[model samples]
Target chain A: MTDSSVPATALEVRLASRPAGWPTTDNFEIAEAPVPEPGPGQILVRNKAMSVDPYMRGRMSAAKSYVAPFEIGKPLDGGAVGEVVSSNSDDFSTGQQVLHALGWREYAAVDASQATTVADDLPSSAFLGVLGMPGMTAYVGLMDKARFQQGDTVFVSGAAGAVGSLVGQLAKLNGAERVIGSAGSAEKVRLLTERFGFDAAFNYKDAPVGEQLREAAPNGIDVYFDNVGGDHLEAAIGTMNDFGRIAACGAISQYNATEAQPGPRNMFQFVTKRLSMQGFIVNDNGHLKREFFEHVAPLVREGRLIHEETFVDGLRNAPEAFLGVLRGDNTGKMIVNV
Target chain B: MTDSSVPATALEVRLASRPAGWPTTDNFEIAEAPVPEPGPGQILVRNKAMSVDPYMRGRMSAAKSYVAPFEIGKPLDGGAVGEVVSSNSDDFSTGQQVLHALGWREYAAVDASQATTVADDLPSSAFLGVLGMPGMTAYVGLMDKARFQQGDTVFVSGAAGAVGSLVGQLAKLNGAERVIGSAGSAEKVRLLTERFGFDAAFNYKDAPVGEQLREAAPNGIDVYFDNVGGDHLEAAIGTMNDFGRIAACGAISQYNATEAQPGPRNMFQFVTKRLSMQGFIVNDNGHLKREFFEHVAPLVREGRLIHEETFVDGLRNAPEAFLGVLRGDNTGKMIVNV
Candidate 1:
């Protein structure tokens, strides 16, 4: 790869404005910028894929959250995987695939220190989903935060989404007695039970979450990996056994709500059942990355774990892809192929 | 003392009927029962003081809770301190003051194993409040459940109540930078700061808990000892700093509600602030008793701690005393002295 072959200009996605409610494509804009050469200690990469996650919604608004809000008129950044087209650092060479936080763009001049070299054994998109942030989020949220035990009954909401899809499988693979999941649609519910090896799955929209969760987990759940808060959280609390643990990963249900949604009506059960609920951000738990990879990478390599991705072609459609993620349109990891 | 010294017939408070919402005196019955002699390995105790706690309300109803419901025609049992008139076991001696769970009665024949002899260093009523279940609850809830750290800002609801009153003092004595409390009455609010050493105090009824808590803890609270749930829990969640903790000791506000109430609406803050909320029952954490006694008993003995009690004379008025507890009429521990 030479400087002559690299494109002079490339497209990137920017936040046009903040949305009052559910974001539309109009909130995003595609702008062209000159692709730059790698400076000292940097690598110029041709981005192959980018991730569009539900958490990014928090960054879209100006409200203070765990992560800083995305600046308007600047290209949005997230998990991305690309090939090093040019390198000016000893850490990387041309043609090597690296993962970095420079997504929603065609090419990025990433600092070599910031980008990590990923193995060629898996698809580049795998770095954005299964072997990346979502995968680690699932591992830490269940194994550590929820303190999942062998033979424990585990329940996860948003069963078919990126992080959620892996949570049920991880619990099952780790010797869970029964794995239950709640999803928005029958198809996702099917995916949860059949593909993810969950013992029971329910479409949360079909009936009240508490009723369905009770029917699905009659004995009660010991560990709850909460991705969809609101009714799902309430149902989990209601159906939890004594000393149950709740990993508050995300509250996607209330992300776009104009008003703050009411929490579980059965919170008093927290005292009665002696339940523990903890909210966490995956970024803070990077210390567990090596342990997570050691356990999960093999599962992905042997095809024991499902590494699903729902890809939307081209950086131009990244906004639409993000919108699809918010609408629960994607079954698993929703990715944008640049 | 001899068996003849023990009264042959004693007054006992019984549940005449379960209440729908707010309980009235009609819901209770003052009955007479023959006080029995101590059986093998039993002690005949002349009840001195009995605890009239908010938790009794839960047992009054037939609803499934941590403990079994109070039988309709039987005497309600709770923490009570009494003088043993006769003992059949070597563990206790006659005339020894012991604490047992045979409250709401003038005299009780208790199994020696169920009664523990309390020291005379503190008032007999202290065994039912600061040195007993409520004391242990405050200790475990703050020290273990909430994992309180030195210099942490602490907030406790129901600050004038038994369990809550001790929580603020314990936190302050253990080197808390600030201790904020919320009570139901203006006088209780005054008592929190003036008598209990709380840094700031507010009457929750005077304003919204969120606004008042925000004003009290401008930098945000690190630990919330929740006794009154509902709005208090929500407000605490809102005013909590990153990595804050909530010890859900009790939900006295919802104990009498006919229907389940909605929980915190701003629960998303749990994730945003990386908060941890744990509900606990003091019975489960009995392992920490020795540690609690070592730390707290000294405070009480030295007069560094306040063990206030509002006593209602005679077992005939036990139900009224319990109702007073439910109505938040007591300053500290509500007791029925027989």
Candidate 2:
């Protein structure tokens, strides 16, 4: 057979249906489309790795939010790191590696300006995890939103996940007096203290989160990096010190609930403790990108900061990778290698 | 009766028992004690007026908070304005009017350092309402805590009461683009728009707060001064614009609820909208007192800022005045004329 016998089509994952509670494989559809041509100021990328983040769950629903919902019968898009295969712009070369928001597909045609060029020294997939959206989220939420102090006691929920793991390490490196974390499993709890250098860690399933948090932080926490909402938020509020601050990045726990969950019943604790809580999206703080990279890249390059990834191979498996994120079945960043 | 037959005792209101939920007359005890004698660095004041504020409800409970709980069988203390009848310190004289945290009593023996001398131009009782804790709470909550912008659309809950009434007026005078208020009664709603110069006012008791708020502020609110929490807080969250700020000064609606009230279930709105919520107490922000008086005192003297009071005369009726505050029975500041 000749080399021309190989198919030239690209595989993509599309939204087949809106989810009712928890999304299943039925919600996603696999399809093939002709590879797109790059126009002026645009580049065609062959995606190597892509992210499946918790925030994407909110975008799946046809609800009013900061970002628009993913339309049905269209390819899903998110953080992706890939090699430029065709270029119609002077800024990007055919062989250059870049990061862009065009994932769950084998090929992407995007404006050159939307694609950020990455350093060649590290693995290209690192841009989809620790060097990309998740990294920036941890930095902005801790330094800017929470106003983390040098000696503050910090508590992080979802400590085994990508953003949460970075948040705990950053707090420790910045001289936090004590760093406490809560994870979903015992193995994740062990990884938090031993691998991430957390002062204390606990599995939330072991006991009531409020009691466990109180025990983990007997002196009370001054800052809380909230990734999981619902019970975690309630417990954090209960154990917060006076004039505490909470940086709300994500609420992975309640993202797929069919009905509205009960909120923190003891919200009055906010008043009594003079607490300040602010919710933020990393996209809003893009101005801090230069500062974030300067501070974190060195630590990462020197092996001072650790990062992990759980990869699911092939574009067809992207939907399962995303579902795994919602189920907390993977640690660190959940990505699909296309 | 002869002039010599007059008793030289001072009447005081004491907490007879801790309130289970809502406080009643039976929770207070009327007692008489000899007028206190001033010691070195102390002054004996003959209190003319005392404030019954919403925060007192929190103090009646034994739960730990920013301020100490009111002890059983002990005199209740709060904001008071009075004449310094006996002074052992050089800073004060017998006829000087002053304000101190020694209310619910006819006479108070307080350290001279704890008493703030009032300007002679305004009535003495003004120190307990417009020029005292309530007034400072409004200024700090708006300017400092909420970071109110000059042209923001402002919404104040419990808008006919002491702090909320002033919050709306200040937003107006400070060049808010639009000022909206929500009150409990139709009369109070009318007073908010007509007397307080709010652009729009709604009676929350007349309709669902969420629907009414959306109608009142079609463009959405930029800042929310939350005095009445529960439904009002929930509705404010529902109607807030992106990057909106909430100053949670009080939660009067839930103060008397026996059960833990459900919080704003749509708190995820905070994440999508990038909202910041802060809870504050005026006592922690005493440094703003000078700036507050400098900005507001002239407005009061020039008839630009209005002051209203609902007076309950005599120490014996102090319990009723406090009860009325919790029930929203009076408009503006509820004070006992001792």
Candidate 3:
């Protein structure tokens, strides 16, 4: 399509309705729309990769969350990586790959100046997975917010997910004496310890989180990056050392619960240990943006940071990929390759 | 007991039994012992007043808390104010008022070197209140831990209690635009608002703390000095603004809960608002001793800071004073005048 072209487009899945317990196939729908034209300072990019995360479930319902809920009959937007096909601005060329908050669509006309340019050294899809929000979240969370020390013991929950996998690797790279992780399956546990270089890994189904953590971190946990809240947070609270710091990046476990979650039962432990639990969102904590790119880019180029992405081909399968992320079916980043 | 010629003799109270919930008169028993002879860097003092706090509940029970539990059949120690009856060292002298952690006792033979000389210009009783541990707790929690800033709206629970009262006054002095406090009775409410100059005060006994705080701080709260956790903490959570700071100073409400407290059902507000909740003990942060005294002395001297003392007549009444503090009956610092 040319820069001025305005063609009709169809999306195979828009959030049709909010889910009660778990969002079923009925929660999303296939829809069509007229393709938008590239306005001034806009460039039309054919999306190559799109993301679906557990956090998106909170955005699907109309309830209040860190981000707004997805509207009915409208395409859900997340981190997207794509190649520019048509442009009306000097900053963007027709062939350059970029990353932005583009919706699950066949094509989009985004402002050329908006969104970061995907680094030229890596695969364009990496922009949607590791080198994007998830990567920044791990880096900034570990170094800036959690203030993890060189020899600190770190525990990451939902350790096989996109952010957790990276968090484990980064913790080790940052000179953590020990890195422990918990995932849903034995295969994920193996991957975390062996492939991701986590010092210890456990399949949460095999044992209670408290027991698993106690065995894994005998000296007590110094830093905990909580992804799944509920019982995982409870366990971490039990095992934290004095002056402990916890970065509450996400709570994937209780995200889809119809009823409210019972918070960690042993919060009194926080008082005993003089702990600090800070809930954070990765919004480029100003100085960490530069540090993150400098540290992560080289690791990526050297293949030290391995990325695994589950891809669903075409715009039609985007809804299914998103559902898969909420189900924890994806090994790492769940992406739609449209 | 004379300093040079008279053999050292001292009167003291020791812990007899651990209490179930509230400490009683039987839990303590008086004992006569040789007055501690001050060695090198030691001072002998005659105790004038002693401080009792809610945290002493943990010390009495054998439950693990921020501090160690008191040994059974041994004297319980905490912030104590005394006049040095005899001195063997240069740091202290006869008739000089001093402060030390020597509670449930009269006429302590503390090492001259161990006691901090109560500032000359400030009230002697202030050594157990605003100029001592309680005052230091309020300062550090507000300035260093909470990172409270100008124009912030702050809410203090247990408004008329020693730490809570000073927290409200200091918040106002530090340029907080709105300072709200919650107390148990109408008289406490009046004391907080009218006497202490709190922007708003509500009797928590008559109303839900959440509703009261919502009405009092309609705009939202920026900092919360959480002295009485449980429902007060839940209410504070509901009214916190984005990036809110909560200083977990004390939890008098939750301490005596016969059953498990149903945690604030809406704790996810921490995630949405990006809240930071940190627990601290003043003694554990010993590095701030000089800074705390330096900051508080001038204020106490100028009458910018006022400390209320709820005094019991004798060492025999120490148990009742401690029990009264546990029941939230004390308006300020609960002390035993030995």
What TM-score do all the candidates reach, one by one? 0.98, 0.96, 0.96
lDDT of 1 by residue, A117-180 (tens): 9999888898899899999999999999999999999999998999999998999899999999
C-alpha lDDT of residue A90 in model 2: 85
If ranked by DockQ, best first, what sequence of candidates would result? 1, 2, 3
lDDT (C-alpha) at residue B99 in model 1 = 97
Worst 10 residues of 1 chain A by lDDT: A1-10
Writing each residue's lDDT as its tens digit, candidate 1 over B229-275 gives 99999999989999999999899889888888888898788788989
In candidate 1 chain B, what residue range of length 10 has the lowest lDDT sum? Answer: B1-10
Q: Number of clashes in every candidate structure?
A: 0, 0, 7
Q: DockQ for all models, in order?
A: 0.82, 0.76, 0.61
Spell out the clash pairs found in candidate 1: none
Docking class of 1: high
Sorted by lDDT, highest first, which candidate order results? 1, 2, 3
Model 3 chain B: which ten-residue window has the lowest total lDDT?
B1-10
- For candidate 1, give the lDDT: 0.91
Reference interface contacts recovered per candidate: 0.90, 0.76, 0.51
Highest-scoring model, lDDT: 1
Candidate 2 lDDT by residue in tens digits, B166-200: 99999999999999999888889899888989999
| Residue B95 lDDT in candidate 1 | 83
Docking class of 2: medium
Error of 1 at A267 (Å): 1.1
